[model samples]
Target: MPLDTGQVDTGQVDIGQVDIGPLDTGPADLDLEEGNGVLNRDPLQSHASIGEALRAVRQDRGLTLDELAERTRVRRSYLEALEAMRLDALPSRPFTIGYIRAYALALGLDPEAAVERFKADEPVLDEPLRAPIGVPDERDPRVAAFIAGAVVIVVAIVLWNVAQRAMNASAPPPPKASEAQAWKLLAETRSGPVTLGPPLPAPVESTIPPLYETPGLAEAGPDGKGNDSAPANINDLSDAPLLDLTTLPATFTPKGKVYDSGNPQLGSLVTLQALNNAALIIRGTSGSVYFARQLAAGEAYKVPQLPGLTIDVSEPSDFQVFVAGQSKGVLPARQVLASKLAG
Candidate 1:
């Protein structure tokens, strides 16, 4: 080998045979994670039920019931029902779907997919929806008849009152004093300058008698010495105030059923009118933040319907809530209040 270094040997070197696998140019058959469509395990399919799927997703995200409730404005009870697959406990189909859609979106899942899964789990009713009782249909003949009767009765009462007024006007003329006497009285009264009574002097405190002191009976003994008979203070027996609970104003509760205006876009429109300056945070049921700011006095904010439609304010007493043109009453400052709207 040392001798061959000086000269170039014209010889072909033998290379050993080797096998090569085909190049992996195509997409790799990689397995994805549970939520990432991985390993042929659809997170949706792996679960025994839709509720299980939802619960898994929620748990995987480390969301608690209270946390989700605060986030979504959906009640904690309702969330529990959803996780438990208590279909009967949820609201109507439309409302339930709304809740599910919002929840799915919050969990970063496909809302449509969640909805479809939920629909499969819950059975739709074949029977038509039942209307609420006591609400009369406007097309009912009885309603029209009642209205007509009321109008007729009101008209009759008005006509009777009018006839009585006409009769009284035609028949009445009181006996008059002589025109000369009337003129004389008017002339005498009108000719004089008006005179006002002298102003009364304010009472002196020393001159005022004691509450129990009688005009004639003195507290002094027969010898004109002071008698210890009178109490230091005479407490009025009649003036003794008795607490009357009945005098308190009756509690106010909104009357009549609330009919949905059928505005799906706005479940419940609430407006806040600040009576004094306040800081507040408004959140949807899903706990989505809608507003957070210091609102000045007399400022008004109309908030869209959100989950739970909740508000947390620094000074609740400084503001009032209005819904559908009705006052909900003053808010308790520094407290969180949820919407009291009917389902």
Candidate 2:
């Protein structure tokens, strides 16, 4: 058979000249198999642990733990535990999975696939289901009575004001006096002018002696010309006895004890005060959160007396910590401050 060089036959084709687009370098989906009512049970699909895979991706991206923590907002210690596969050291299975997903995505890895890998490593505990709460019926008799009472009160108030206005309008006006009658009343009240009297002389001085005068005591300096010496000591006075402080009261008063700052000798009464509106978190030694909320300026929190506690603040300079009534200054931002009380 003869073929034309410029035109290809409809029945014949050249595989070398066909354009199939670019090659697919991405990974392929896992092969699925049906066994024991399960699909896609492949052992080779995930050989490395979730932490191992995440650590590899993170290292390949050349990111440090601190950098990833800043990006993901996960604690560096948590990330370290995740990388080390210390599941017991983590918060919980669900929280750890969430952390894994966030950490994996931060490193440019498939979060869903990473979560699946983590599920396989740790048992996924199902959260207990809670029933929805029911609201009270608004058509109840008590509610209707309350509403009716309120409406009656309002209507009574309106009606009382209307009645008060009507009564004021129906009342008679006060009587007005005529010009002739007013002049007659003024002439009857008028009287003669008052007589003048002469003024009396100033008061005379008394001749009684001062009650406080003494025989030997120098008279008060007369116009600053009398004695200029100091007053006699009260100890020289024989008429009055001095206070016997030594025998009157011999009770011993206890002195207040001074406490050291952040010392273990003091009782566990810890308090935290905020200088600015800021968010903070307080956790126990077991890593369980005891308090997590935003506090306004001058707001304070008295922590329950616990064996140990760790505090984390979003703003370091905005917080003032008190350990056993002693000021510990502001906490370091995003840093954990830990303390323990004496046994």
Name the candidate that leads on TM-score.
1
lDDT of 1: 0.65
- Where model 1 places Cα greater than 4 Å from the true spot, the runs are 1-40, 131-343
lDDT of 1 by residue, 221-285 (tens): 54355665443211122222233435322332223222332456765556666766778687776
Candidate 2, 1-343: lDDT as tens digits: 8775886557854333322323433343444333322222222133457787677767767999999999999999999999899976788567988998899778776788778777767765686954444655457788889999999999999999999999999999889999999999898778567678898887769878769867545665533346676544322212222333343213212122212234455444556666678887878779898778788876666566555666677865676556666654445334454543111
Every model's TM-score: 0.29, 0.25
Candidate 2 ranges beyond 4 A from true positions? 1-47, 125-343
Task: Kindly state the number of residue pairs that clash in model 2.
Answer: 0
Candidate 2 Cα deviation (angstroms), residue 6: 27
